[model samples]
Target: MPLPTTLVWLPETVSTDEEAFLLAAHFLGESLDGLSLSRDPLGKPYPARQGHSIPCLHISNTHDGGQRLLLAAKHENLVGVGLDMVYLPRMRSPYKNRAYLHRLAARFMAHVEFERFQRAAQQDDEEALRRRVAAHFSLMEAASKALGTGLKIGAFMGHSASLPLSALGALQIEPWVQLFFDDLAKTRLVTLKAQRWEAYWGSDDTYLISAVFLFGNEQSKQALQLDYP
Candidate 1:
C-alpha cells in the first residue's frame, strides 16, 4: 500500500509555510496516490482521506521559520516523527554574544548542560559555542515536536514528590529539575537523550535542521493520542 517506513523528503524552496505543507502533502500523496493529509488533534500531520481512517503514516514538518523549510514523513507504521530547523546565528547575532548565550542557555538547558555551555564559552573561539547551542536547540525543538505536543512548559509544575508525566514534555531543562531527576528515578524524565530518541541533523552555513524519528513505544502513542487537542 503506502511506501516503506521512514519516507522523508526535504524539497527545496517554497515561499510560505502553507506552500511548504501543501508541497509536503502532495509529495507524500504522489508516492501513495489518493492519500491526502490531515492533522490529528495535536496538529501532527498524517495521511488521510474522507471515509477512511488515518493511516499509520506519521509526518513531521519543520516549525522553525527561516528562509528555508523542510518536511519529513514516514509510513508503514512508524509511530512518531519531528522535523525542525534553526537559523545559525550570524557573526553579529545576539546568539554569538558569549554572555547572552549563557544566560539563555541557563534558562532552557539543564544545569549540567548549561555548565557545559559555560565551559565552552570560556574558549577564545565563539563559533564553536554558537554551533553547539544551535545544534542542541535543534534537538530540543525536534524532541518536543516529535512528541506532538510542542513544549509542555507546564509539565514542570507542582512538586517532585509526584513528578508530572515528564516524558510528554520537552525542553524542561530547568536547573532545579536536574537534582530531582536521575537515571534511576521512577518518574519519567523530561530530558532528551541521544540513545532513546534519534535526532539527525543537517546544516548549511546559515541554517541547521533536524529530523527525529522513532518506531516509538505504546506509551508514546497513548500520550500523543490522548493528551493534547
Candidate 2:
C-alpha cells in the first residue's frame, strides 16, 4: 500500500562511512544534535547518543578502492549489522579463471567445500562457479564485519580446519544449486557454535554484495566497562 523507503548514496557523492552516516541523517530529516556519530571498540560506526528521547543507532560500513561506501543502521540494539559491497571485476581472476579459483579455494575454503568447487569446475559451469565463490566470500566478510572482528575469523579462507563439526553444516549447500535468487541473490540463516547468524548475499553483472547481522545476545556478549556521567 505504501512505497518502500529507499536511500541511495552514489559512489561519486559519498566516499566515507561517516559522511554516509551524516547523509543518511540528513535524508531522514533528523537533526545532528539528536544523534551524534560514534564507533565501538572495533572502530565500527554507530550513534553515540541514546535514551528514551534519543534513538539507539548502530551502523556498519564497507567499501573497496573507489567503489561504494555502504552503511546500515537500526533502531534496535541488535548486536550489530554488517554490510559489504565488492566490485566483481576487482575479484576478476578468481571469478573467470577456473585455475585461479581452484588455487584460491584450496587456500581459503574448507576441504570438502573445495572438493565441491572442483566438481563444479569439472562440469564447466564457469559463471555459476564464479557467482558462488563471490557470494561465499562476500557473506563471510559480512559476518566478520557484523561481529566486529573484521576477517580475523579468517572469513572463508583456511576456516575448514578451525570450524567445529557442527559449524561445517553452513558449507553443505550443493555447488550446482544457485545460492542466490535464480542463482543470483539469496538470504541465508546460518547456525554455528549453537548460535544463529542472518545474511543476505547476491551478485549481478558488476558487483557482489552482502549484509550480515547477529541478534541480541544470540552470541555471548563481551564485557564492556562503560563509564556514566
Candidate 3:
C-alpha cells in the first residue's frame, strides 16, 4: 500500500537554525529563495509573506545538531502541511546523574504516575524501560514550539498521552517520544505522519541523537510505511 507521506532525518553536517529551516522547507515543497523567514521582531519564526496566506501549516524542529522534517498534505487536499524535529542529547546533562534523575522524575510525575514509574525503574520492567526511554520526547515540546504553536498550546504530555514523562526515570526518553508522537497522529488540526531517525558521531560516541518528522498527511499507506526505515 502506498501512503501519502515524506520524511527526512538531518544529520550533524547541516547544523544550524538556517540549515534546519531550509531542510524543513524542502520537505514541505518550499524553496529557500521563495520564502523569507526571520526571527520575528517578537522572536517567533513567521513567513515574510505578511498579507498572503501561508497555508496555515509548515513546522520545523532542531536540537543537538539533528533535525526531523515531515511533509504532509491535507486530508486528500495535497496543500496543507506541517513538520517538526528535535535533538535528543541536549535535553539532559551528563548521562546517569542521580540528582538529575530525581529532578526529572519530580517534574514529570503526577503523584501516582511518578510512583509507578519508580517501581518500573526499580523492577527493571521492559515496558517501563521503554517508557523511560521515550522520556527523551520531552524535548518534543520545544519541537512543537518550533512547529508554530509553542509548548503552551501543544503539550508534549498531550502528544504522548499514554506514557507520561514523569513516569519514567533517567535511563531513556524514547517511550515519551513514541507517545508524544501518537498524540500528534490523532489530531485533526493537521493530519500528522511522523518518523524517528538517529545518528552517531565523535570518537567517543558522546552523542546519542534522534529526531522526529511530523508531516501533514499520508493519504496512502505506501508513503506512511517509509516512516519505519
lDDT of 3 by residue, 63-151 (tens): 44433433322122223222333233443455635445656655654454455556657755443333343343333333343333333
Off by over 4 Å in 2: 1-7, 26-31, 50-56, 75-77, 93-96, 112-124, 153-195, 217-229
- Give lDDT: candidate 1, residue 42: 57
TM-score of each: 0.61, 0.64, 0.43
> Where is model 1 more than 4 Å wrong at Cα?
1-22, 25-34, 51-55, 63-68, 75-77, 94-96, 116-124, 152-196, 217-229
Clashing pairs in 1: none
lDDT of 2 at 217: 39
| Ranking 1 against 2 by TM-score, winner | 2
In lDDT terms, how accurate is model 2?
0.51
Better of 1 and 3 by lDDT: 1
Q: Indicate the residue-level lDDT of 163 in model 3.
A: 31
Clashing pairs in 2: 108-157, 180-185, 181-185
* Best candidate, TM-score: 2
Can you write out model 1's per-residue Cα lDDT over 76-133, one digit (the tens) per residue?
4455566777767553475458776666556666554555556545763666666656
* Model 1 TM-score, all chains together: 0.61
lDDT of 3: 0.38
Give one digit per residue, the lDDT tens place, for model 2 in 1-229.
Answer: 1111214444676765667776766665556665566665555566554422233345666666466655545533355566778677666664458667667556656555556556655765666667667766666566555555454344454322232211221242342121211111112222211133455676678887776645543342322211111
